[model samples]
Every structure is written in structure tokens, then in C-alpha cells.
Target: MQNQVRQLLVSLQKQLSVTLQSNRETLCHPVAKGDATEDEWLCLLKNHLPNRYQADRAFVIDSEGKLSEQIDIVIYDRQYTPLLYNQNNQIFVPAESVYAILEVKQELDLDKIQYAGKKISSVRNLKRTSAKIVDVGKSVAPRPVTAILGGILTSDSLWNPPFGESFQKAINSLTLSQRVDLGIALLKGSFDVSYTEKNEVQTKIEVGETALLYFFFNLLWRLQRLGTVPAIDYAEYLKVIDELS
Candidate 1:
């Protein structure tokens, strides 16, 4: 069973790497190429992740009516939290529903890493509210918000050694709000970083054929740890409607 599972994962990893690399090489128009890559990543997540979660390109909005910059891929809850807007294929997710945001690029470099961090900050900075839940005629207190994960995905890495000293330095340079928790260079490897209560940082990198599998498993583990998104405070949104009226 173990060997069979391993072989299946290996096949998946190879397929993902090849597909992403092919897109990078064949697509010349930057925007078209980027969109294609984003679609690929979104498809992977949507197919592999639990149905309770929704993945797409979206902008996150807060109760205050503020919107984050457009995000490449947003992993959000669909079971409870409602999408704010969906028109012409554009989606607006509420801050409370977001689980993670990923930026897709053709290559991974310091510039791209910093860009992804900035993009991540736009989503993380938004306000999220939790509302009470009524279950079985009982009122449950509002749940605290979970930290949203941020990441970057690319076909390949600019750094020769991928997750080396320079890569570490670039990741370390991000401010707390801009911190990236994960990165995947499909052709090279995958990496994840964690912070302790003391703000100490620990990084783990898987630099070989198992890059996709490592990323998929690690992402699932992290998402599992996050439990579920808090119940959204719809009353706050109602206030906006009141103002409009």
C-alpha cells in the first residue's frame, strides 16, 4: 500500500511539473501565460482539496467596504461564508472566509518573492469578524480568526540552488504582515516556514522529485490545523446596506 501510494504521488508530481513547465515555455504573452498558470494551480487545488473549500482568483473584501488587491489564487470557505460578489467571472471573497492566498509567476526570484509578499499583505491586512453561531437552539461564542496562509508558486526558480542562502535572505526580509509561509518551484522543490511563539523562524525545504507531493501534503496538514473559518459577521455588512439605503 505504501509503495503504491508513493508511486501515485510521484506520477502526480511529474505531471504537475511537466504541465507547468510546458505552459511557461509555450505561452509567450505574459498575461495569457500567467492566467493559464493560475488556472492550472486552481484546478489542482479544487480537485485535490476538500469540497468545503473553494479556490479561485479573487479580491478579498472587509466589512468596511475595503478591498484587497486582486489575488491570483484564493482558498476560501464556501460551506458557511458567502461570496460577496461574483460577476463576469470576477469573485469577491470576504476576509473572514479566506484560508490562503497564492501568487503565481513564471519564475521564482527575489523580486517575485517580494511581489508575492506585498500581494499577500493586501489580503492579510483586511479586517475579519466572527459572529456567534446558533446550533441546536444553543448560542456559541464567536470563534477567533485563524492566521491566513500566504505562498508563491512558479514553474521554476531563478536561484541555481533554489532554496539556498539567497532565497532564505529574501524570505527573511519580509515584514510580519508580508511573511510568506510557503513556496513551490515545481521544477525545483518546495519550502515551508513556521514561526514560534517567540517569533523564531524554522524553515523546511524539500529539494527534489517529491516537490509537488511535499507541497500538497504540507498544505493539507496546515489547513487541517486551521480547523474551519469563523462564522462571518453578516450584521457588519448589513450596516453598509443600511448606509446605502
Candidate 2:
């Protein structure tokens, strides 16, 4: 059973790598290439992740009406907070529903890492309101908001030694609010970061054929640790709308 699972994972990784490499080689327009890359990563997450999670491209909005910069891929809670908007294929998810946000690029580099961090910060900086939940005819106190995971996904890496000192330095340079919790270069490797009790960053990098498996399982473990998102305070949104009238 375990070997079959491993085989399936390996096949998935090969398929993704080939498809993305095709996109990079065939797509001439930069925008088209980027869009295609994002779609591939988004679809991978959507197809593999649990039904409780919804993955898509979206602009996250807070109750205060602040909108985050567009995120390449957003993994949000489908079982808890409601979808705020989806019109003309443009989505706007409530900040409270979001679990993780990722930026998709053709290659991993210092510039791409910095850009991803900024995009992540845009969502993390937003305000989320948590309200009490009614469970089993009883009022339950609101769950505290979980730290939203942030990451960058790419087909390749720019560095000679992909997971060398330069790569570590770039990741370590990010500010607390802009920290990237995970990263994946499909053809190269995957990496995950965690903070120590003293707030120091610890990173684990996996290279070779099992890179995809490492990333997929690590992502699942991290998301599991986050539990469920808090119930959104819809009243806050309603109050804002009322004031606008």
C-alpha cells in the first residue's frame, strides 16, 4: 500500500514537471506563460487537497474593505467561511477564510522570493474578525486566527546550488510579516520552514525524485496543524456596507 502510494506520487510529480516545462518552452508571451504556470499549480492543489479546502486565484478582502494584491493561488476553507465573491472568473475571498497563499513564477530567485513575500504580506496585513460560533445549540467562543502559510512555487531555480547558502540567505532575509513558510521548485526540490520557540527560523530542504512527495506531505502536515479557520464576523462587513449607504 505504501509503495503504491509512493508510485502514484512519483507519477504526479513527473506529469507536473513535464507540463510546466512544456508551458515554459511553448508559451511565448510572458503573461501567458505566467498564467499557465499558476493554473497548473492551482489545479494540482485543488485536485489533491481535501474537500474541506478550496484552492484558487483570488484577491483577499478584509471586513474593512481592504483588498490584498492578487494572489496566484489561495487555499481557503470551504467548510467554514463563505466565498465572498466570484464573478467573471475573478474571485475575492474573505481574509478570515484563507489558509495559505502562494505566488507562482517560472523560476525561483532572489527577486521572485522578495516579490512573493510582498504578495504574502499584503494578505497577512489585512484585518480578520472572528465571531462566536453556535454549535450544538450552544455558543462557542471564537477560535483564534491561525497564521496563514505563505509560499512560492516554481518550475526551476536560478542558483547553481539550488539549496545553498544564497538561497537560505534570501529566505532568512524576509521580515516576520513577509516570511515564506514553504517553497517548491518542481524540477529541483522543495523546502519548508518553521519557527522555533525563540522565533528562530529552521528550514528543511528535500531534493531528488521525492521532492514532490516531500512538498505535498509537508503541506498537508502544516495545514493539519492549523486546524480550522475562525468563524468570520459578518456583522463587521454589514456595518461597513451600511455606512456606505
Candidate 3:
């Protein structure tokens, strides 16, 4: 079964490659941007990463309720509960349920380390709260959370930059489990997926599946970018998925 699945992946990859090559000219065209804000970029990364990772779901919450809530991404289970907050809040949540929290900073500042630590503390608080709630209510279930910090730096230099340092700090600070399990899809100039081995696998999958899923996710990402869909071919993509299945 593993071999069959791997074979299917390879075959799909070849088909996708051919499709991308045939449509190279069109694909090369600029991916139209919306407002070019950090949030928009984070949203794009979130949507794309999940599809690439075959994740059940991915989401972004701007910490609307809390002062320290600047979480950029929160990956959840298929049920859509919070696994992790990118930034921490005073509210207690489960640490095990949280996959990871990604804090995106555009620049590498020394102060951001302190900022990251503060977020972790808030996350710990949420865990405590979640535990208390669970203890009070027999119906309540426990969940875990993880946290990570990501910095996006764009520069022409090929070597010696704050980008590398910022990334190192984020990775170093995270628990080993979080470092291994978290997804931080950072985009500066083009999209960079070299943060970890898992990210590398995800990038390859995206490239491999581009032909089959391009139009599907292109429309999705574009809609996310535009914040609306002017036109779509929903049935057509569904037909493709059906055929593929």
C-alpha cells in the first residue's frame, strides 16, 4: 500500500510537471497581489502550506481579544479547534493540543526575542485556563499547543543577513517537538520553503501537485488575495478530483 501510494504520488507528479511545462508561460505571469500587507502574505502562506502539507486545516487569528494576541497562524485539527496560537494570550489552553504558533516579524530586531518569550508566557497562561475549565466540566476535553516565531526579511544580498539569525533564534527557542511539527511558511521576494526538512517536503509536494491542483488552489489563493471570487469553476475542479480519485 505504501508503494502504491508512492507510485500514485510519482505518477501524479509527472502529470503535474507536464501540465506546468505546457502552461509555463501562463504560470510565470505575476501572481497578482492584493494589498501587500504582512497579514495578506501570512494568509497566502497559511492557505498554501496546508494544501501542500495535506493538512486537515489551517487558519489565522489576529488576537482580536487580547493585547498580546498577535498570533499570525493557528493550525487546527479537522474539527477546527485551536491547536496553537502564534502569539500567546492570558487565557489558558492545552499545550499538547496546540501544534504550533507562528509569530511573523518582517524584520529581525533584538527585542523580538523578548517579544517571543512574552508570547510563550501568554500561551502557558492559556494552557492553565484550559486545564481549569476542563477540570470543572466533565464534558471538556484537553488539547495541546506549541509556539514558534518567524521573521520575513527581503534583501538582495546572498550571504550574511539578519534573516538567517532571526530564523535561528526562532528555531532555537522552540521546543524540539514544536520545531519538528510546526509549519512556518515565510515569503519575502518569492516564497522560501527551506526552513526545515518538512517544509522541503511540502515544497516538493506543491511543485509535484501543481498541475493537478493549480487551478483549484490558484482560484482559492487568488480569491484569498482578492478577498473575493469574481468567477469560478467549482464543478470543473470537482470533476477533476473525482477523475483523479
Question: Which numbered prediction scores highest in TM-score against the true structure?
Answer: 2
Model with the higher TM-score, candidate 1 or 2? 2
Q: Mind giving the per-residue lDDT tens digits that candidate 2 earns over 151-188? A: 99999999979988989888888988899999899889
List candidate 1 stretches off by more than 4 Å: none
How many clashing residue pairs, candidate 2? 0
Q: What TM-score does candidate 3 get on C-alpha atoms?
A: 0.33
Error of 3 at 7 (Å): 21
lDDT of 2 at 95: 98
User: What are the per-residue Cα lDDT tens digits for candidate 1 across 109-163?
Assistant: 9999999999999999999999999989999999999999999999899897888
Residue by residue across 141-230, what tens digits does model 3's lDDT show?
A: 433222322222211113244236554555456442233221222111222222455442222212223322332343234223422111
- Write down the RMSD of all candidates, one decimal each: 1.2, 1.2, 16.2
Model 3: CA > 4 A from native: 1-36, 51-68, 78-97, 128-160, 163-245
What local lDDT score does residue 169 receive in model 1, on the 0 to 100 scale? Answer: 88
lDDT of 1: 0.92
Return whichever of 2 and 3 wins on TM-score: 2
